[model samples]
Target: MLAPKRSWIQQVVYLIGMYGQFLKVYVKTLVEYRADTLIAVIAGIVAQGSTLIFLTVIFNRIPTLAGWDFYELVFMFGLAATGRALNQTFFNAPFLLTGYIRNGRMDMMMVRPVGVLFQAIGYSQELNGVGQLITGFAIMGYSASHLDMAWTFLSVLYVGIALLCSAFIQFSILLTISVLTFWIQEVRSLIYPITWLYDFTRYPLQIFHPLLRGLLTYIIPYSLASFYPAAYLLRPEQYGWAVWGVPAAAMVIVMMAYFIWSQGLKRYSSVAG
Candidate 1:
């Protein structure tokens, strides 16, 4: 039988505890295979740098995108990078659900005392976060130097909170996509579209039409993962709304994601169970 549903705060604490345990195992596993880990880390950093460079090239040709200047765009990109990194580090393994199910790993997890979803997402160091950290901070620095902002202590704290919410959104979206494994049986085909959302993230919602942009900002809100945070970081005076909206939206999205994942879990059929 499944564990009884707990209070929201308890659920979060449980998940965090699971993540800590899994991260420890992940690090130990990587330490055993140090050479492969080093190679993978380096390759990941190079790939991240290439992506940032491509963004720079695009901005060089087009001065401003949807009224968002270059540095602002870069800031959004940085936020995107950081969010993606966190998602990959923590929740990306959910994408492996179908394969695990097909191969009987789901049965193994079911026998464990911890929650299945927690065990799945937090199973592995993501070995790649280090590289993403480097490239993401580099992108942030580039934007910080070019963009004008009064960085007070409060502002920095707000920005940090915004970034964390962005990461939460990123994790939620990936979980939704990955949960399809219960039906699709294979998800490699979906990776590109989910990753493409990162491209859409680098600009303001205004680049699209008013209706489309509005829908994106509210309904789907993937772009908001970065653009909203950048709005606060770049033009905090004009977009004071983010001071409230960012966390509120993140809370809503995370709740929605949790609900969806629970339904997906109910739908999952264990070959062994």
Candidate 2:
């Protein structure tokens, strides 16, 4: 006899429960390895710390860069770090798709009842992102306190939503690049150059040349992940569009990524004979 099909809501609930189980096991493993977790956290802290030092040196020479004060720039840095950390923490498995495909692990996933992408996303979480999360939030809190802006509940909620949308944009981009592995079977070279674009988003968008600003705003939209959202919070009149635009862009990019992944999956071939 055939089994009954679940409704959409039921399926979503099932997936959430399954993901919870995955998290339980993942956390248990992390807890089992105290040294590894500590090292990963320290690495994240050091990485962000170096960026902070560089910013400090630049500010020491001048009061502001491109009309943005030191704390304002720090706020953007914190937003970027937080968004990147979220991507690393939850969606990092896409980076390993090349190996998974080459080793027939993807073939194994194909036979499972769960969706391939869901299983892949739940496969592992980056412990180092915990460190990044700490530093990012700490920096944001410190900078916010120093800034003259008022922080009400609504403002906090808006910032939280912006951060989630920023992370979504990044995850969509990474997943889109990873999907190329289905055809090329290796995407490290392509991914590196694209990821380098994110460096430009660490500073004020107004400072960059018009061409570079256009690239970040329209082509890759990395600025939506950091600069635009941060700017919307810091200077609402100047970047008011981001209030609607960031989430809209995230939805569009994620839809595009999913379509590409589906197409790539259809063309996927197994290495096994």
Best by TM-score: 2
Badly placed stretches (over 4 Å) of model 1 are 1-18, 29-32, 55-63, 210-215
User: How far does residue 232 in candidate 2 sit from its true spot (Å)?
Assistant: 0.8
Best candidate (score: lDDT): 2
Q: Write the per-residue lDDT of candidate 2 for residues 1-273, one digit (tens) a residue.
A: 232489999999999999999889878877999898888788888999999999999999999999999999999999889888887787777777887888889999887888888888898587878788878888888888889887889779888888888777887787889899877858977877887788789899889999999999888889999998899889988988988988888999989988998999998887785
Model 1 alpha-carbon miss at residue 149, Å: 1.5
| Backbone clash count, each prediction separately | 0, 0
Clash-forming residue pairs, model 1: none
Q: With candidate 1 superimposed using the best TM-score fit, by how many Å does residue 241's alpha carbon deviate from the native?
A: 1.4
Question: Could you tell me which 10 consecutive residues in candidate 2 have the lowest summed lDDT?
Answer: 1-10
The runs of at least 3 residues in candidate 2 whose Cα sits more than 4 Å from the true structure, single-residue gaps closed, are 1-4
Q: What is the lDDT of residue 23 in candidate 2?
A: 89
